[model samples]
Target: MNAPSGASGYDAVVLGGGVAGCVLAARLSEDADRSVCMVEAGPDYGAEPRHWPHKVLNARALPRDDVWERHTAVHRIRARVLGGSSCINGCWNTWGSATDHEEWVRAGGPRWSASAMERHRLRAVEQMGLRAVPERELSLWARAALEAAEELGYGHVAMAAPGRPGFGTPLINAVDGVRWNAAFAYLDAARQRPNLTILSQTTVNRLDVRTGRVRGVELDVDGRRETVVADTYLVACGTFGSPALLLRSGIGPADHLREFGIRTEVDLTGVGANLSDQPGIFVPLAPTPDLNAALAAKEASGNLYVSRMLIRAASDLCPDSSWDLHILPSAGAPLFGSLPPGQYEAGISAFLMKPASRGHVRLRSADHSEPLDIDPAFSTDPDGHDIAVLRSGLEIVERMAVSAALKPLAGAAQGHPSRDLSDEEIRSRLGAYWHPVGTCAMGQDDDPWAVVDEEARVRGVSNLRVVDASILPTVPAANTQLPVLTVAEMLADALRTDGR
Candidate 1:
């Protein structure tokens, strides 16, 4: 973390040094004149991969370290490290369906179209070092799952590039077993800049807003209070953190901020609304003896990837030529809890990629350290569209589990979660894929709930912009890592152009 020298303050104070924050700081600092400071709540651990925790570097399993919480609720869990969720996710990267872009183009104009974003997308790919899964990394279960999808009439399709719905491996940001996070990609070289500052383990309390502008940011640095003034304050604190920061600064619904006894600066109703995440249901299966032995051998070689391929299958409710469900199968160490020395857990999971159900994030209090109140509200849409689509996906899971290609290795399904339960039971046992977006959504000024404009600048507040997943009005039907990185890179380009 950097300190306050004789220099007054930074040119741009980028709050929340997550995926987007790292990119913004690196790109903006390229000019050699713009002073940029990146504030992150978690420890930076320096710029070397060897300096990072071993658990964080291992890509075979999602690490519990460097996260916001360590409870049983997976949906509420979020990364708090400099690299953010990229340091803790499954490393699967997918460009969502074409229909998702149509929605983005409508909300954010032609600049968000597929053709427009392609350049930025390719740049992110190169910077992040995303690559296809190699043959050595695929476990026997993954191979069998691929054959199973093929047997079921689905052909192999590239998951990284936008294309028709099919099954194939996703582009991964991992090499060997190390997790290649955004900090390593974007922030390593930027740290050498004399004008760039990386502040870690520093908490942002709130923004000092008066009238229609932000004056400075109130931060809690090493138990001491400080105020950092900047020409512009950009909030890239992610989907949950971004909204909570706005609400604590008195920018959310006037009625909600009043409940916290905070002074209101702007009454933005969409600061923490429209939370979207992919909810999934896992169907357990009894692994065959040979399958267990094969998995054991793979683990011995340190090349065991629980899931290497995924099926993007279109449900009845999905838009034509686009998929709304991600069917994943896995056989490895349990995602939660543990298995015996030689035994492993096997299952097929159905993820509702394009859910219609919307949720929200709210501040429990004005305190910055306290957790925000988050309600994913999965499968709660009034029309039951999410429920219907999820059930349809599970139906596919059941068929895949019993298919000849998979049955020989996984034996038989213990019982499908949806076989005999009501919709309530289905909802109770559901787990999240951990791809969340849309808290501070983007829109035109006329839209009542729009928090930011197409340029990601917050409404009614000059010089305050939000460039993260929170600004996405709709969740794409794919993992959020790639999309968020692409958005940050694109916005950084625009901001650099303006400064020039």
Candidate 2:
């Protein structure tokens, strides 16, 4: 309603300066003529890595700082920083199977094919400087896990690209001990460009979508309200944040918006529906004295990463050439809490990579600062397929525990082993892999569940697009960091090709 209060309008105003936002802002501004602005809810430590908080830059552990919610439900955890989850995740990069591309191609188009997306994936890998886990960085626990995978008949294969089910170390975006997040990898150099403007500590209140087009964006910066306009508005606020923003702007299910008395501009029910995320259960193991000592030494040398190697294992229910699980073995400082001086936590976690269950994200209210109602619905499928696949993955955990390579390092199950646990018990222990997607999934126009089209444009809304993990129709059977980066890169290419 009101004229934009501050700076002049931009060619593209990117909401949420997360991983995808960074890539889009950097790539779109490459034309030099197009002005781009990236707005983030949290602080940006500038372009210098040395200025960032050490806890955020440290690759060995997940820092609790710069998070949306703290000491709350683990399932709702997501970073609020400029670099997004990349600043707080495990710093590992792994690619999904070709089967994942088939699913995407079915929903979107051939552009999502493995071959079509390969160049984008490789570009993301190169831009981030991803490298395989060095021998010194692999803790003794990880080395033993590698041996156990080989002993179990899983032939070695790369983790950064698709291949038959196998075990190997993942490529990492970390250098030495520093976590090279998207901000550092993509935005650092872009900061030097005059065409790009990075706005930190700015929260998007809502989009002024009128006549099926975004008019302007209401923002809250340092408690001061203002409006910013752009020719094209790109929402890269991530899975949870993106849908929540749309809902606040009355772009979700009409019935739900009516409850909050917000006028609905679009009646799309898929804006926040079809939420998908990987659910995993950790089978804790009591480490041997030698294991703890080795881990301690690794910590002393700043190389103690909780996990480095993983096995892409096919569940019995999985297809022939695809894997449905990631068997992760880790031993080091606990992800959440600390241990006594030389002691540590050790375990093998079985992650249900390709799950069938779905969840939804809803607006708690119209307030921008209010957290969205997020339900992962982990293992809540009606037919119990997800629970069964997770159970099968746990079986792999049991076998990995008993292998000669791991049995000597980590003695036995410390508490109730996953194999002996009932379905309900296992569900109680379920932890998310921190990969949430499909909030604004892409699909054909005929699909009622589809929110966005193949080009990441929201249905029935012009001058608006969502370029982030939120646009993915399903969570890939891998950690989502690299995939998100690649998706951003591909969408940026699409924008460039169209000259929008």
- Tens-digit per-residue lDDT, 1-500, candidate 1: 65453324878999988899989999999988899888999889789999999999899999987887777488998889999988999988999989989999888999899889999999999999999998999998998899999998998898988888999999999999889999999999889899998888888999998988888898887777788889989999999999999999989899999998998899999989999999999888999999999999999999998888999999888889899999999889998899999899999999999998999999898998888899999999999999898889988998898888899988665554456767998999899999889999999878998999988989999989999999988999899999999999999998887772
**After aligning candidate 1 to the native by TM-score, how far in Å is the CA of 10 from where it should be?**
1.3
* Shift in Å, residue 296, candidate 1: 0.1
lDDT for 356 (candidate 2): 96
Per-candidate Cα RMSD to the true structure, in Å, reads 1.3, 1.8
Instruction: Quote each prediction's TM-score.
Output: 0.98, 0.98
Where model 2 places Cα greater than 4 Å from the true spot, the runs are 1-7
lDDT of candidate 1 vs native? Answer: 0.90
* Per-model lDDT: 0.90, 0.91
lDDT by residue (176-237, candidate 2, tens digit) is 99999999999888888998888888889999999899998999977888888999999999
